[model samples]
Target: MGSTVNMQKQTDKVNLFETQMTMPPTSEKGSSGNVPEDDPSFNPFGFVTDNPSSRSAIQLPETPAEDGNVGQMLYRTEDKGREFGSTIKSGKLRWFVRETGSKESRRGTVVFLHGAPTQSFSYRTVMSEMSEFGFHCYAPDWIGFGFSDKPQPGYGFNYTEKEYHEAFDKLLDTLEINSPFFLVVQGFLVGTYGLTWALKNPSKIEKIAILNTPLTVSSPVPGLFKQLRIPLFGEFTCQNAILAERFIEGGSPYVLKNEKADVYRLPYLSSGGPGFALLETAKKINFGDTLGQIANGFSSGSWDKPTLLAWGIADKYLSQSIAEEFEKQNPQNVKLQLIEGAGHLPQEDWPEKVVAALRSFF
Candidate 1:
C-alpha cells in the first residue's frame, strides 16, 4: 500500500510538470536593453584577473564518493535514470554536476546556482525535491568549487568573475540546457552573476527565484564575507577545517552536526586542497559595486518575466529588507516571501519552504 501511494504521487508530479511547461510567459512585453549585446567591450562578469602561475586538474571520478557521511547519503540518492554525476568541459576547465530528473516527459529543466564557499552541494535537498516533482535539474559546482577543477595561484588559476561566467555558459552549452527553464539562485554573489545571465537570456528562462540572496545594495556585507576575503587570514580560514566549520555554522543559524558539516567540508579539502580557490573567488567580490550595477540594470531594464524573491528571515549574511526593497523597486513582475526559521542556507535549514516556493513560483 505504501509503494502504491508513492507511485501515485510520482504520477501526479509528472502531470504537474506537464501543466507547468504549457503555461505561457508572464508577459508579452519584449525585452530590450536588458538583453546583453555581444559588444567587444561588454563583459558579463565584472572583471578579469590573470595568474602568472601554472595549474593542474584533479581527476575526480564522475561519481559522488560512496563512503560519504549522512549529509552525502541524504543528498546523493540515486533515482534510477534520473540520477546523474557527470562533467562538462568549458575550455581548459571541467565542471562537476550532480543532477537528477529527466527530459523524457518533455517538461522543462531547472537550474540551481549556489553561492561562494558552498558549491552546488548547497542545492542537494532542493534539487532532489524538484526532481521528484518531475522537473529536470542541473546543479553544477562552479569551476573552483566542488568536484570541478581548482587552479592554484601557483598554477595560473586566478579565479575571476569573467572566468566564472564563461565556464557557466560553456557548461550549459555542453549540456544543451536552453532557456524556457526555471532558475533558482542562492546567495548575493551568485545571484548577481546569475541575474545578469538571466536578464541577457530572458527568452531561455521561464521563471526565476532569488533566495536569501543579495539583490540590492541595501545591506552591509556580512562579517563572514569580509573575513573570508582578507589576505592571509582569508586563505588560512578557508584552508583550516576548524575555522571553515565555524564559518559555516555561524552563517547557518541552525546547528550542523559534525558528520553533516564534514560532508559540506569535503569539497574544500578535495584532491588538491582547493579551499584557497574559494578564498580567491571571495576576495574578488565587491558587493557594493556589483549590487549597485544590478540594481541599476533591473531598474531601467525591460524584463517582464516572472520573478520571486524568497528570503530566509534568519539569514545573518543578507538582511530580509534587501529582498523587500528589491520587490518594491520592481514590484510589477516580482513577489517577495519570507521563509521563517531558515538562515543563509535555507534549503538545508528548511527544505519544505524552499520546495513549496519553487512549486508555486514556477
Candidate 2:
C-alpha cells in the first residue's frame, strides 16, 4: 500500500511539472490573464512588442523632467533655427533662413542644401563652424520644412522640382546672394535637385561638394520614398512625427543622441506641414530621370567645376564604389575623401571630419 501511494505521488509530481511547462504566458495577477503585450520579463517568450509602454526613439517622452533643461528649450527655438535665423520674403513666401557670417564675410558665401525629410538643422553645427572660418554660411529650411512656412500644395507652392528651383532662386535673389557661391549638398530628393540645379546653372556655382547622396543610375530608392508613393500608406507614413530622426538613425552607424534627435523631431511635432511637403516631393520626383540627369551632368567632360566627394564610407544607402566610379569618371577635378566611422549623412555623423575636409578643399 505504501509503495503504491508513493508511486502515485511521483506520477502526480511529474504531471504537475509538465503542466507548468505547458501553461500559456499571462500578465500579472491584477491585470487580465492575456499574454503581456509589453515587458518581456512578464511574458515567458522574452520578447516585447512595439507598444507605447516601451521606450524607444519613436516613443520618446516629449517632456523629460528637469529644472533647467537646455535640451528641452532647444526645441522651443525650433532647434536653434529661429535663434540663428530670420524670415525673408521670397516670391511671396517667407523663408526661415539661417545666416551665420556677417554681411562683410571675408571668405566666400557657402549655401548648404539639405535632403528630404531633413531640414537645414543638420547643417547648424557645420554652418556655425564654417562661419567662424569667415565663410558666409546660409542654410535655409526649404519651404514646407523646419521653421519655414508650409503652404498647402496648390496655389503658389506645388512642391515640384521646378517650383523648388524657382523658390530657391527667388530666395537667393531676396537674400541678395548674387555672387558665385560654394555649395554643399547632401541627402535625397531635394538634395539631388540641388545637384541638378547646379548642373543647370554651372556659372552660379564656384565649386561643389557632395556628401552621401545617390549619384548613379543604379542607386536604390529607399523604402521611405517607396512608401510615400503608396496612396493611403504614403499619407500615413508621412505623418509620423519621428520619421526624420528614424531615417537618420536607420541610415547612420551611430544612434542619434536624444538631444540631437529632439532637434530633428521638433518640426514634425509642431505641424503636419513637413511631413506632407516631404510626401508631395517624394511622390512627384522621377528617380530614373533625376538620377540620369545627375549621372550625366557630373560625368567626365560634362562637369567642369571642381567637385569634392566627402563621402561617408559607412553609408548604408550608397556604397563606396559609387564614389569610386564618379571619381574615376572625372579623375582630375572630382576629388574623393572617404570619411571613416560615418554613415549616410556624413556632415551630421562627423562634422569635425567633414569640416576638416571642407577646410582643406574649399
Candidate 3:
C-alpha cells in the first residue's frame, strides 16, 4: 500500500510542476514564492523549509528500490510465498497481501477496501492503527491501482460487477484469509462491491465499518463524478490526466497544503495511476440497478453482521444527512459516529478519530 510520505513527495513535485508552468526556468529565487530545500527543484512549500520534523504523524515509507517496484520485493518473491504480488485466475485479478500480527495474538483480520483513484494507501493510517490494536490488517491495492499490473486498455479496467467480486474472493483465498474478519470499507470501493460481497458471504464478516461511504444510488454523488457517468464525454474526460488531477484536488481538503497534498498525489504520479479503473468506477456509477441490488441485498436482512458508520462531518462528497438517514432507517443495526473536521478522506484529515472509532468497534 502507498504511504503518507510517498503522497507528500508526489504532491510537492506536482506543486513544482505548477510553478514551472507559471514561471520561467531562469526566474530569480523566490520569484514565484518557490524556495529550495535540499535542491533547487525541491520545495516542500513555497517559503517554508522542507523539514522532516514538521511532517504529520503519518510518515512515508522509504523510497522503493530503483527497479520501479511499489513495495518490498521480498513481500512478493516466491520465497515469501508470493504474498504481496499479482495473480490472475478465472479472468479475475488479485493483488498484494501484507500479513500482520502473529498467530498467537491474532485477534482478527481486517480486509480494507479503498476508494476511487486510490489504492490501499488510503488506509495506511487505519492499517497502522489496526495493527496496534492486535488485528491482522490485510489490505490490498486493487488490481488496477497501486503496484498491481495494469492491463492494457480494453483488456481490463472496465471491470464488471461479477469480476470485482470474484477478484476480491480470489484475493482472500490466495492470501489464506478465511471468514470471520471485520470488513472495513470506504468511499466508492465499498458502496456496491464490498457491500454485495458482505451480503453474499455474511458469515465471513464479523462487523462492518463504513467510513464516509455511499451505500446506495440515492446517496450523494459528486458533480464531476456525475458528469463522468456520461457516454462519449465521460470516457473522453475520464481519460484526461489533467481532469483526473483536478478531480483529486477538488475532493481533497489539503490539496493546497504542501505536506498533505504531496501524499495524496503519489499514487496518481505512479505509472498506470487513476486512468482506467477510475473510468470504470464512473461507468458503474450510472448503473443504478447494480447499486440498488446492493442496497436491496442489505435491506433484505442478509447481513447479520454488526455495522458501524463513522462519518466525517466535513466530508464534501457524502453528506452527513445521508448518515442521519441511515441511522434513522436502520436504528437497531447501525451505529453512526460523527468525525469532526474531517473530509472525505478521514484517515488523512483526522487519523485519531478514525483510529479511536475503529478501536471502539474492534
Candidate 4:
C-alpha cells in the first residue's frame, strides 16, 4: 500500500520510534552480489535499505478522536479498537489482534487475513458488523505489519511464503482456533498466502471468501510492488507514509477522506518496520509462481471447500472478469458476488456491501 511521495516531505514527517538493529543478509536466493562488503546486509542484491530507519515499539500512541461520522469508529483509530485489541504471543512473533464477540459464539468462527501494505485495520468495520450477527471474529495484523511485531528479515522470521504460512499456523494454534472455521482472505502476497494456507489445510477451513486478491496468472501486479522490486528504488518505496492511501486511491474512482487516510498512514509514519517488511516480502514472491499455484490449486477437482468470490467490479488492479473466470472453473463450489461501486480494497471502499455479501454467504 506504499505510495510515491517526495523524499523531502517524508523525512520532515515526525519520527515515531527510536530503535536500531544490525542489517541482515539476503534471505533465500541471490546471496551473492557485487555490492560493497561493508554493507550491513552483505548480499549486494538484498532489499535491505542503505540505512534502516528508526521504528516505534509494538504499542501504539494515544488514539485520535472520532469527530466525523460513518458509524462504529471506523478504521480502529479510536478507543474502540485500542481497548478491544490485545497482543498474542506466537512463537518468536507478537501479533496484534482485534477480537469481536465471545470465543464461544454459536454462529461460527471467522478468521480475517489482510494483505500487504495494509493491516487488519481494513477489516475493522467488516469484523464489527459480522460480530453483531453472533459470529466470533478475529483479525490479526500479519507479522511485520500493523501493530504486530516486525522482526527483521533473516532474524527470527523471514518474509518467505513458507515462513508466513508457518507463522500463521502457529498463531492459529496459539489462539486455539482448532475448529473448522470460515476464512476470509484479501489482497496480495500475504493475502494470497492466506489462500495458499487454506489450500494446504483444506480440512481446517469450513468455507473460504476471497476479496480482490490475485487469483490467476493474469492478475496484474500493481506498480507499487513492481517498483519495490527494483534495487535502490524498493528501499525508498518502503519508507513512504501514504502507501495505503495512494494504493487505494490509485485504483479507485474516489479519494479517501483525511480521517480514513490517516488510519492507513499511521503505521508507516510511526515506524520503518512495516515498510521494510513489505519490501522483503515483495522481493521474495514470484508472482507467476504464486499465481500459478493459486489458479491450479483452487481449480475444480482439487478444491472442495465452499468459496465466495465477493469481488469488487471496480478494481483497477484485477478486473471483474478474473472472478467470472475463476467461478467457471469451480461452478459448484465457487459463488461470485460482484460489488458494483467498490474498487481495489473493497472492505475499505465499500464495507457495507462487503458486510452484506459476507452476511449472506458466511
Instruction: Please tell me which predicted candidate would have the highest lDDT against the true structure.
Output: 2
Stretches off by above 4 angstroms in model 2 are 1-83
Collision count of model 2: 0
When sorted by lDDT, best at the front, the candidate numbers are 2, 4, 1, 3
* Segments of candidate 4 deviating more than 4 angstroms: 1-83
Over the stretch 64-115, how does candidate 2's per-residue lDDT look in tens digits? 2221233334345453445478888887899988889877988899999999
Q: Weakest 10 consecutive residues, lDDT, candidate 2?
A: 5-14
TM-score sort, best first: 2, 4, 1, 3
lDDT of 4 by residue, 226-271 (tens): 9999999999989987786678766754455444555666667667
Q: Which scores greater on TM-score, model 2 or model 3?
A: 2
lDDT of 4 at 311: 88
Cα lDDT of model 3 by residue, 1-362, tens digit: 22222232322222323333443343353353433346535523321112122122223222112122323222333142223334444234536544455444467778887766555655666677677788888767666665555565467545666667877777777666775888888767434577777878887888999887776667766776676677777666655433433444455444334334333344444444456666666675444765666556655254456788888887767788877776665667788999876667676566778889988987
TM-score of 4: 0.78
Per residue, candidate 1 scores C-alpha lDDT tens digits across 43-137 of 33211010001001011111122234434333543221123667767777877888888865356799988776666766777888888887899
Judged by TM-score, which candidate is best?
2
RMSD of each: 18.1, 13.1, 8.9, 13.8
* TM-scores, one per candidate: 0.73, 0.80, 0.71, 0.78
Screening candidate 2 with a backbone cut-off below 3 angstroms (N, C-alpha, C), the clashing residue pairs are none
Per-prediction tally of clashes: 7, 0, 6, 3
Model 3: how far residue 37 lies from native, Å: 22
